[model samples]
Structures are given as C-alpha cells and as structure tokens.
Target: MYKLCHQQQVDNACGFYAGHHMLVIAGSKNIRKPEDIVLSTGPLDDWALAGLRESLAKFIMSEVISSKGEFHHPTATY
Candidate 1:
C-alpha cells in the first residue's frame, strides 16, 4: 500500500492507502481539529465525497486483480 501511494506521491499515504483497499470501513476516533482555515468549512460535500468513494472502489478492483499474482508491482501501471 505504501509503495502504491508513494508512487503516486500522495500525502498521508498510509491512511489513504488503507482507505482505498480495506474491505471494512475504518474511522478515526482522534478527531483533531484542522489547523487550516480552509478545512474549517467542515466535511466534504456529497458530490465530492461520492467521487472519493468511486475512486476507492476502482482502487480496490485493481488490487483484487493484482492480488492474483499477475503483476510483480501492482502499482506499476500508475
């Protein structure tokens, strides 16, 4: 997962990677407030959140295919 996200240069790769691949949904209990005022607008709106969900689903599908031992590095295509 780290390799996958690192290849894409994603920030907070660990959490985002897990979110993309995990079958069971995970939530954070830490709930720290955002330091940036831009984030103070609250959670993402429905449309934006839906787009994220779609991306996660696509990632999971790709992982499932790669897990069949078809690719040496599953993230190589990215």
Candidate 2:
C-alpha cells in the first residue's frame, strides 16, 4: 500500500488522489472553502459546485498519478 507522509495526508489534493486510487480517505476536514480557492470564479449552487470540485479533484489526482508525484497540490490546476 502506498502511504502518504504527514504533509501529504493533510493536503486536500493528496487526500482526493488517495481516495480515488487507493480507496483511502483522508483529511476531509482539510477541504478548503470555495471562497478560499483561488481557482473558483464565483458562487455556485450546491450541486454545480460539488460537480466542479469533483472534476477538479479528479484532475489533480490524475496529474499526480501520471506525473509520479511531480505534479501535485497547490501546483496542479484544472
């Protein structure tokens, strides 16, 4: 099993990647508010926002995986 270090475990991007690929959920509490996300354009309804977040999360996860950790959170963008 791939294990994340403390820093990775606490990161939202890393948590998302682990959840999808490893079936390991971590750092749910670390999810940032929409307003806190610089990539967010504006307010979105619950469902739309959820979809956007999910897409972004998946994109980040894919990037990290394909790049072998070269692409990661705070750097991986949609």
Candidate 3:
C-alpha cells in the first residue's frame, strides 16, 4: 500500500483487506466490509512517504506514554 500510494501520489489512506479471486480497494472514511471496499488512490503520504510509518509509530508511542502519565521524555529514567 505504501508503494502504491507513493506511485499514485496521494494521502488519505485506507487499510487493505485481502480476498480470494479478486482485489478490492477502499478509502479511510468509507468502509462496508473487507471485500466491499471502495476503490481509491490513497496513502496520504504528503510527499514524505518514507517516514510516514515511523513517524506515526512515534506519535502513537507518545500517546501511549501520555496515557501512562508520562507526557514528556524524562531526563534520566536509568
């Protein structure tokens, strides 16, 4: 999907769900079923595709830390 998104050049991604004997596509905002996905040209890379996944992962980590009562990085947790 990242490669597809980069090739097509778009953002606003949708998660892919594989199926048998066919290919189905969908967008982030609209989903009916795994096989009932709407066709799309997405991934919303903002032209920074290479870093998107890592950046999102870091963002999620930050959110998790915030939920755990640690909103900022500690100077020394060793």
Candidate 4:
C-alpha cells in the first residue's frame, strides 16, 4: 500500500500506509473478520473505506504507544 500510495502520489502517504497496516493487523488479530477486512479495504469506493482508514490509523497509533517496549529508535543511545 505504501508503494502504491507513493507511486500514485496519493496525498498523505503515511495515512495510506497507516490505514493499510491497521487493516492487516485487524485481520490477524480477529478484531474484524477476515472477509470484512478484505471487503472493506479492498475497494476504493467502499462506503466504509474512509472511516476504516481514519479509525485504523488512530487505533494503530494508540496501540503502538501502549504496547510494552514501545517503539523507539535503535540509534538512540540514551
């Protein structure tokens, strides 16, 4: 999705990437059934696409910060 978004020059590539990542994570975690995830995120015209993308980005970011050993740069020596 990142590559596609970049290649297509979609506005806010990070949003596209974050949204795609959320959909994948949701499918794996069973937050939503795989079929629903596939259908919702697969089509550009799907009514739920915008909502799913926006919410997933927020949800994923929240999870990232809340998870144990939260993300940090490996180069940070402090």
Per-structure clash totals for the candidates: 0, 0, 4, 0
* Tens digits of per-residue lDDT for model 1, 1-78: 112212333455435434433422233234353221122123334575466678866766665545654333656564
Better of 3 and 4 by lDDT: 4
Question: For residues 17-66, could you state the per-residue lDDT of candidate 3 as single tens digits?
Answer: 12111233423336545544444444333454334456556765775445
| lDDT winner | 4
Candidate-wise lDDT, in order:
0.43, 0.45, 0.40, 0.50
TM-score preference between candidates 2 and 4, better one: 2
lDDT of 2: 0.45
- Which scores higher on lDDT, 2 or 3? 2
Tens digit of per-residue lDDT, candidate 2, span 1-78 = 333323333344544433333221222345555333222223334575465478766876776655555575555454
Off by over 4 Å in 2: 1-43, 67-78
Pitting candidate 1 against candidate 3, the one with the higher TM-score is: 1
Evaluated against the true structure, the overall lDDT of model 3 is: 0.40
lDDT of 1: 0.43
Pairs that collide, model 3: 10-44, 11-44, 12-44, 25-38
Clashing pairs in 2: none
Report the lDDT tens digits of candidate 4 across residue range 16-63: 555655666565766454444432233344444576667766765654
Q: Using Cα atoms with residue i matched to residue i, what is each candidate's TM-score against the true structure?
A: 0.33, 0.30, 0.25, 0.28
TM-score of 2: 0.30
